[model samples]
Target: MNSTTINLPTPLELMIDLSDDQFFDLCHKNRDFQFERTASGILVIMSPTGGETSNRNIELSYQLQAWSRQNNLGKAFDSSGGFKLPNGAVREAWATPIRSPDASWIQSERWESLTQEQREKFLPLCPDFVVELRSASDCAERTGEANRLKTLQDKMKEYQENGAKLGWLIDPKTKQVEVYRSGQEVEILENPTLLSGESILPGFVLYLTVIW
Candidate 1:
């Protein structure tokens, strides 16, 4: 939470601008990569994760989805789901900074409030609970301004600023988790064996055995 940087992927940033529909078409055309445009209009590209990251990510996603199903408390999503944070800085259909956290959940009431058409597209608001699982590649050493760890950290802050109630930035490599919540400083847990969803997720708990 203090002044620190966690660098993420060395993204390929293109200066070109695309409309919402245009970006959607580009995303579909290059389905293998992740395309994101920052609010300032910088287009970034992230590649598909490696196998180990994929495996760990599924565990996170599966556990969250299963918990949401049992509790009937919210809708859970995998990394493929995109969210359009309500920054009010961009147009409606194609918003700036389309984010796809590794695992995310929206409270049931909020989930149900969206119209079917709205639900089918990038979610128009930040999630109540979100998780970003860091992989080895994401933390690989890079020179200059490329910092994968800082990238996700900034993302966590962005989620909080955009109205996320709680977020966990988990790093399997270090067995550490940075907990972010509204109106609170970041909490760092070292080699924690488990994580509680706390009030945001009610009784949901995530055991780190498989992930670690």
Candidate 2:
């Protein structure tokens, strides 16, 4: 008798630029893989998260989803949800980047305002709250964005700048969470067991043990 093992694939980064329609079509055609387009149009091809990462992600998403259900104020998203971020005021009018935070939430009003067709496509708005988990293996690498490169921390800043009311960058390896908010300095919390949603997500809190 023979048993075969399967391997999890790593993301492949490409320098090619794709138009919005082309990118959206690629995502629609390839349902099994995840894709991200930077503001400069560099495409990132991603595979599903490995076991440990997926377990951690689901816990985080579950907490947010439960809170969202009770409050009825917003929608919670798992890792597969995509968002189109608005351009920063300080930069030239560049192509908007579409990103998928590990776990995210959009206010009910904002989500409801979109037309059915708009809702069916890559969301044309940033999530009100975003969370990114930096797996132990992702510590050393940064991804390219045209000429600029970004680490997970940089992605948190991008979320804040792109109108996310709150963002958290969680690193399980160090047991630290970096908090980002509009008009506020990034707050670094070390080994914090709980995270507050503050005014932006009133009455929501996350217990971190499940993530660690």
- Residues 1-212, model 2: lDDT tens digits: 99998764356768776777788899999988889877766687777767898899999989999999999998899998888888674255366788989999999999999999988788988899999988644753443332221456767777887898899988888898888988899898999999999998899999998888
* Deviation (Å) of 23 in candidate 1: 1.7
Off by over 4 Å in 1: 1-10, 88-95, 143-146
lDDT of model 1, residue 177: 97
The C-alpha stretches of model 2 lying farther than 4 A from their native spots are 1-9, 88-93, 140-150
Q: How accurate is candidate 2 locally (lDDT)?
A: 0.82
Model 1, residue 108: C-alpha shift (Å): 1.4
Task: Indicate which candidate wins on TM-score.
Answer: 1
Backbone Cα, N, C clashes tallied per candidate: 9, 0
RMSD of 1: 7.8
Q: For residues 1-212, what per-residue lDDT tens digits would candidate 1 score against the true structure?
A: 68987656546777777876687678878988877776666787888888999999999998898898998988999998888777763334343777889999998899899999889877888999989998776777653324778888988988888789999999998899999998799999999989999999999999898999
TM-score, candidate number 1: 0.88
- With a 3 Å backbone cut-off (N, CA, C), the pairs that clash in candidate 1 are 6-149, 6-150, 7-147, 7-148, 7-149, 7-150, 8-147, 8-148, 8-149
